[model samples]
Target: MKTFNYHSAKDVKEASKLASSSSAFLAGGMTTIPSMKLGLATYKNIIDIKGIKKLSGIKVSGKAVTIGATTKHAEVANSKEIKKAIPSLAALAEGIGDPQVRNRGTIGGSIANNDPAADYPSACIALNAVIHTNSRKIDAEKFFKGMFETVLKSGEIIEAIEFQVPQKSNYQKFPNPASRYAIVGVYVAKHKNGINVAVTGAKSCVYNDKDLAKTLSSNFSAASINNVRVSSSGMNSDIHASAEYRANMVKVFAKKAVEAC
Candidate 1:
């Protein structure tokens, strides 16, 4: 691994100042550290945000549930507030990579990284969660642009994610055998606006299944998805699975989530 200077910031302001150039912010370091070590990423400095107290915890209000950025996946999975407000989110967090990954992978890192196959982004999109940054809050619908890309600006750190309490929600994933990253993951939720279906791992970015969403919005039931045809036109293709296979999985998961809800 290449050598680098390390600094532990006292707060968001200090952390942001250090994150300008050739620097990476460390929350859980579940992915960042490994990428850096493999030379997939290079950094002159590593800013540890773990010491910043504000970036950790779970708080649930009548309006919404706010999860601090540095809070680990394991913590989210075990949070009583989350389990009570939206149990599917906890179940989804519990299903991420493995025990080690869940214990160290923070929701903020996972969503900010916007990994094509990661689970949290699906939940964020489906729930219409608001991503709070040091600078300002961005809606989930506007936050994600593409793979590993977000609207988050330079020196801006994710402070927390606020999820609007949904009427019903469910998440389903077909995980790769060893790595446990989803081959295809889908999150479905019924909100004030409508039913939203966010599919992950099928492509380089999470996409809303408007057809399924419309169907579910009309009738929140598994039978409603029977006539829907999931398209394979823009899905990912590789040795692990074909674009058609991922498309098929999306339909299956949508049905499963409806049944689950």
Candidate 2:
């Protein structure tokens, strides 16, 4: 790994100021540290924001659950408030990687890294969550760009994520045994107005399907998605699973999610 200067930011403003074109913000360092060690990423400045107290915790108001960016996956998984308000999210958190990774990984880091197989983006998009940055609030639909990417600008810090609680929701993931990353994961959320379905792993980015949403919103049943054919095009084809296999799993998991909900 390349040697780099380190700066500990006392607050979000300081962290933002410390970041530069060649700098990287250190949250849990789950993804960042590994990349650095692999020589895939090197930064002249490492702005550690984990010490910022304001960026850690879970808050709930009305029907919304807002989670601070630096909040650990373990914290979210065990949070009673999160469990009561959005149990599916807590379940998703608990299912990430393993005990050590869960204890060390942060929600902000996960979403920021935007791993195509990561679980949080599925929840974020399905819940219609709002990503609060240091400067602006980005809707989940607009936040994710593609694999390992997002709309986050250079130096911009994700502060927290606020999820609009649904009437009922559930998550189902077909995980890869070794990595515990999803080969295909689906999050289904039913709201007063309609339903939202967010899929991950099968695609380059977490995505929502309006057709599936419309069909399920009206029927609210597993059978509703039976006729909704899942296409293999644009899916991620890997050693773990083929695009066609993933496409089939998308439908299968969607049914499972709906049943669970």
Q: After superposing candidate 2, which stretches have Cα over 4 Å from the reference?
A: none
Poorest 10 consecutive residues of model 1 by lDDT? Answer: 18-27
Best by lDDT: 2
Q: Specify the poorest-scoring 10-residue window by lDDT in model 2.
A: 209-218
Pick the TM-score winner.
Answer: 2
Q: Residues 26-137, candidate 2: write the lDDT tens digits.
A: 9889889999999999999999999999999899877899999999999999999999999999999999998999999999999999999999999999999999999999
lDDT of 2: 0.94
Query: Each candidate: what lDDT?
Result: 0.91, 0.94
Clashing pairs in 1: none
Instruction: Write candidate 1's Cα lDDT for 1-261 as tens digits.
Output: 889899999999999998877888888898998898889998888999988999999999876889999999999999988999999999999999889998898999998899999999999999999999999989999999998999988799999999988999999999999988889998999987788999999998988889999988888889888888988999999989999999999999888998998
lDDT of 1 at 168: 90
